[model samples]
Target chain A: MKELIQLIASFVGAIGFSLIFGLHGKQILLAGIGGACTWGVCLLTDFLGCSLPLAIFFAAVFGSFYSECLAKILRVPKTVFLFSVLISLIPGSNLYLAMRYAIEVNRELAMANAIETLTVALAISLGIIVMLVTSQIQARIKSRGNRN
Target chain B: MSLTSVREKDRMADAAGVVRLALDVGEQILLSGGEVGRVEDTVLRICTSYGAVRTDVFAITSLVFVTAVWENGEIVTQSRRIKEVGKCMRRLEELNSLSRRICTERPTLAEAEKAFSEIMKRSESSWVKVLIGSLLAATAYTAFFGGDLKDCLVAPFVAAVIFGSQFLTKKIGGNKFFSQALCSFLATAAASFAVAMHLGSSVDHIMIGCIMILIPGISVTHAVENLIIGDTIAGLISLSEALVIALALAGGFALSQSLFGGLLI
Candidate 1:
């Protein structure tokens, strides 16, 4: 039940961003679903006792692959899906607390939070890079086969 | 062979036209927050399909370089220095679609230019749409972080004030860093006000949701992709841009953290 509500919340967040990003046509709903999927994978991994970074990595991989597939299907740029799909993955709260800890003079907690934030950022990037590399390699092999 | 053939000169002018059209497409893609690879590919594809013997397209965050060579050994080059960047997925979609057609169907220069202009002339997003969208975004962000109904209810109001100030700042056109901080100050202030009224439970949670609206999600995404795709130069530029924006966003909340809610951790 909790997971379901979180999924809906993630969906709503993406819909809101779809509006702000000026996404058009059927993309609005697709973007919302993309967010829900990211959140779901993230929550599931985190619940399975994986580290936070690992959870983010898995979620990001799913989200980026989803974006590529949706882009191909929708015939729009991948960014349309990229934005809404990854919104829920961003470590917004972690960054906020890091800033707060910095301001409050708790240098230790601030540094720890800051480093953790970096981990999340890196995990998300790693996920994107993984998907990007896989897709590029697939394209290369296909192109080579066409030549043969 | 030097300067006697008027027909040769006319062919050179046609090459220039193709280069210009290619640059226009690239400029729109870059301006609309496209990846470096996408921008480069679209420009090259359009130039090649339009009969350019050779083409080179290089784009970064703030500038675009497009060069095309004609069969007559005439070279045409154009550079567009982008002064601003904004997000409009619709424009990006249109550019992608148009580039596909240009590559496959080979539209004439005039036809392609006409189509590109029409894409640019699409109506600006109405303010009402933006405002409502922003409102929804902030409220939904609040819920994403596990905020209760009261927090969600208050966020849209806060988002309205933030958007209003953002609009005002546009008219004045002051320093970007200062404006970013100013926006953060306003958002934090509103969240603090709600906390003071006993309408919300945790200031950190609520403020986290509110400030989530300002984080540079798209910029960071592009920055990461650029860095990995061997576009070290463009990637680093946008990465720094994203870092600075993130710092400014944090600075915004830090500047007002004391004045609001007393560091409710």
Candidate 2:
């Protein structure tokens, strides 16, 4: 429970900062939640000894579902919510580390890490595409039922 | 008031009235300027709570030019007629509860586009964007090969110059899509060249960083959204731009590889 509260606080903090930067409070909040959740899941995967690439991908999928659930509860755009969450998964740290490794002439390590980082980025983004696409189809079915 | 005016007032009240609340959330996601999409979502939730159906609420946010219409009501077009409902924190818990009562649906293309452009023009500072882009690219170079700030800075700087040129070119009546695509390609090529010249690292490293700076991943997200909502035309337009950018980057990478074989990765 304390962990959950901290996560919420961290998400709120990020959103608060985002709000200061001009993002809508609600969207930022949702994004913050998404980011925190994604971060948590990724950390969990690390602890579980899962492949970082696969972990990032599945975590992104988890984030999307989380976004969808929140969007349903909050009655907001899921895509907007999910996209912000994905931003947190951008491997910004990995990207940063890759640069440092390259600068140090640790070519082997740098290449390995870069590949890992890029793959993670790719996986997360791909997860977003898949989730949004599937949800689009689901929305269509709902709309059709409404019309009928 | 005249009896006729009273009738008019009744007609106005009965004429599918909408409830709007303008909550000043704060600056957007990137800390540049203007409130992002939170206002619209908040307004929608509030209106829906007060006996207004999701289809009855219409959000008009000035910063993003986003008029989010959840309900198919009488389309009001003015931005000034909107009013603030309450202070952000004052009704936070109530607002959250209210949001739960509202059932949200996908917004229209026009609405999404307006919001996107407004944020782009406001939330993102060009200088910061460039700085972040350069840092991202530099980080890539430093990670994959080996380089100092000098090496890291060079590629992103070249990228910023290219991107700036595109911005200028856009003002001069050139197509924004084409210009951005070209700019990304040039930026990537410049970084690759820097690597080839042994400026600091391998071409792949710089390219990795450069691509981060150049790719419109955020915009693509919006585009995907537009498509999902069945705004095919808008979605296609955004998709086309994204594709052009990808192709341009690939072309640049290929060209550099052909010209400087040592840098290919």
Global lDDT scores for all candidate models: 0.82, 0.49
- Grade the docking of candidate 1: medium
Task: Tell me how each candidate scores on DockQ against the true complex.
Answer: 0.72, 0.09
**Candidate 2 structure quality by residue, lDDT tens digits, A17-92:** 2332233545655566666777688768867888877777788888888878876886644544564466545554
lDDT of 2 by residue, B89-112 (tens): 212323333344332432222343
Q: What is the alpha-carbon interface RMSD for each candidate?
A: 1.4, 10.3
Residues A1-148 of candidate 1: C-alpha lDDT, one tens digit per residue: 6677678888988888887777877888898999998989999999999999999999999999999999988778888788778888888888887888888889999899888877888889889999989998999999999999
Query: Backbone collision count in every prediction?
Result: 0, 22
